[model samples]
Target: IISPDSVRLENGTSLCSGRLEVKSNQSTQTWSSVCQQDFDQQDAEVVCRELGCGAPSVLQGVLYGDVEPPMRTTEFQCGGHESALLDCRSSGSDRTTCSPGKPVGLTCSEPVRLVGGASRCAGTLEVKHNGEWRPVVYSDWTLKTSAAACRELDCGSAVSVGEREESSYRSVWRIRSDCVESGSALRECAAPDFSFSSSSSFLNLTCSGKPSPCWDNLQL
Candidate 1:
């Protein structure tokens, strides 16, 4: 069985996000890359669960840095409900034609989490983008946008919106005012524009209730 301790995220800014790697039996005991495979979101779900993360939000290829020699390859056949990666059927294999220059990366739902608020459903909004966490700015930020973000985090309806000043400065803003629309998922929004000045203003939101599994199933 592949113990949870044997799996880890490498080169990511957070524990629940980064390139997936597994401890190997190779001579150097080096970590083996878990990218460049034919696995889909179902397989990624298993990886996140094994890492003790909430859920798989993003499954990307070659975003993380590359691996060195002795990289390992495997095919995961997960049913999308396994608790651990080893609980799924996996087969060892040589590198395939789809091998990526870097490695596969994953971002769990926790990356876009709430903070500095009264409850898990309310807080100063922060999002993990390009391996860094940045506050969402208040410029042109609207109620619809806030609702979209809250929905992205699996939080219920957006109940309120406010702003706060940051003690430290951040050069980048993860979301622009018009980036999100009503009834749209945050991932479907455009990438942030870093050209705008780092406004000291940050956005805060309060969500109405618990996560709705139906809404949470919506894809980017």
Candidate 2:
């Protein structure tokens, strides 16, 4: 059995024996014993919280042990019109702690200039998790993600990606990416996953000139 935070076994015992790995806060484990004792599957669990040892003394004289879960990172994708999500506060250090139920939400609704345009048009992309909107970080914005955005917005060819800082931003999620292009239908480009750190703050992208603009922008 799997719990949201930790694992447990029968005989009313708290087992801390081996290593386990979970992704997106979801994981599974298999149990098989060579002993002659009958094992109860109902008492075994991959629990999320620490079980009280002094509650009722479940393990009086039984062979039981537990192992810590392995650390994992979940990768998320960004679309052409959407900026990728980021954990701004770095609040949740563990993947299991940052469960999929608590995923990051990002949105981009500000009008931006494509390539070199006189008027700035904009669209917004929002991530829904735990019922809130968190803006995407622009620090690690990639051309692929930006290109996808341009294509999604029918904003012509992607020429560059830029980041801007705003003081009054609601969520401290004010990373802005600028795309430059022409036309009405934005072309689709493969979005890539980017890491967050001090060194990778600026991103630039150049699109392929396919004369007819064959990229699929309708599917989003």
Candidate 3:
């Protein structure tokens, strides 16, 4: 089965933007220019949506860098509404036609951002997963956890943490309180085995303007 986590952009400045790549045969692989050249706004839309990004903001020739030889090539006939790239009609054996150049690159509207709050930097936390915006339920939501999120969003440092009842938000992922202390990336700290559940509880954060540097970028 193809998991939502299997699709991602690598070698870019952020998780929401990078060189497009897909996982296959228990390994991750990059697509050649054949895939890039074939991609249009429609294909970019599906890829961005599947990665839980807001929308396709930018789709063009390689912005990250070049992929070396032995690259995987595929042709996608996406209807522009598929949930995953693999769901599109694809064929992978046409490597000979691919041009030798940088691979495809994409950028989403906002891969991670704050919402239901006063500003872009403060609000109930929501992260995109599986082409949906889901809440983050920290069993022990704390300053450290909030800090991690703030760092991820480039929203400075966490000053305080609070809770609010927001019944409309449902969470498909959770972060164990203990996982925060290890300084893992917010996405990395996420517990993979949990399923989605509807809940009203959410963490509210206040962060400092001088954000710290952290890394843990995933498409979903």
Candidate 4:
């Protein structure tokens, strides 16, 4: 049987967005890409849930890369409530290998949103990871770094950034600077659990566009 948590996304900008790959442990540890044609909307939903990401937002064939093998030809029949792909019922391969289609490439909605601000584009930043939302804490949060979140929101360019000082130490997701600048989605760049006490800071951003994705390119 494939490991329940063994499914992963590759080649896209973030963990929640990429080509689908599943690993089997019953035999030699090998990763197999799922053919796009065999994966349906419900199958995609299970993959997103298994990755602890938000709902499925985008699915297209070969968007991340070329058709890859060895492909898992089992057609997944999911009801959309299962927590993992392995728990869903599946059918054996109609073909022994991938013949006509590319592997599945998916982009789940970023589990990212702004809160307590003037609009969806402006507010204190929070990201959902591993099923929980937390403020992000990082050392290098310049406009360049902060702008990544704005672009992810499709909320145009970042207009301004502010900091908030809080009380005692609380857990936060520490982001890696290199990861954000690399154009990865903010939630995907989270490093590890972190805590900050006195004089700790949080980011509140304001974007130029109100509620829609306006800017095609992020302003430096």
Best by TM-score: 4
State the weakest 10-residue window (summed lDDT) of model 1. 211-220
Better of 1 and 3 by lDDT: 1
* Per-residue lDDT value at 205 in model 3: 73
Please give, for residues 1-220, the per-residue lDDT of candidate 4 as tens digits.
0114578888887777888888755478777788776788888888988887888777877778876455655788899999899888988544458854578888777787878897888887777765777776536677887777778888888898777666646567677767787887777677556445665676677888655533333111
Query: What are the runs in model 3 whose C-alpha is more than 4 Å off?
Result: 1-8, 12-17, 22-35, 58-60, 69-79, 89-97, 109-112, 130-132, 141-144, 165-172, 177-185, 192-201, 208-220
The TM-score, computed over Cα atoms with residue i paired to residue i, of candidate 1 is 0.49
How many clashing pairs in candidate 4?
0
Tens digits of per-residue lDDT for model 1, 24-98:
664677677775555678887777767655577667766667666445666778898887766778775645444
Of 2 and 4, the candidate ahead on lDDT is 4
lDDT of 3 at 68: 65
Q: Go through the candidates in order and give each one's C-alpha lDDT.
A: 0.66, 0.28, 0.64, 0.74
Q: What CA root-mean-square deviation does each model show from the true structure?
A: 11.4, 19.6, 6.3, 5.6
1-220, model 2: which lDDT tens digit per residue? Answer: 1122322333221222211122232344533221111111112110111221111112111123332233243332222121112211222433332222221111112122233233232323322222234334455555655675556444555566555343433431223343222221111111232443433222223343333334222110
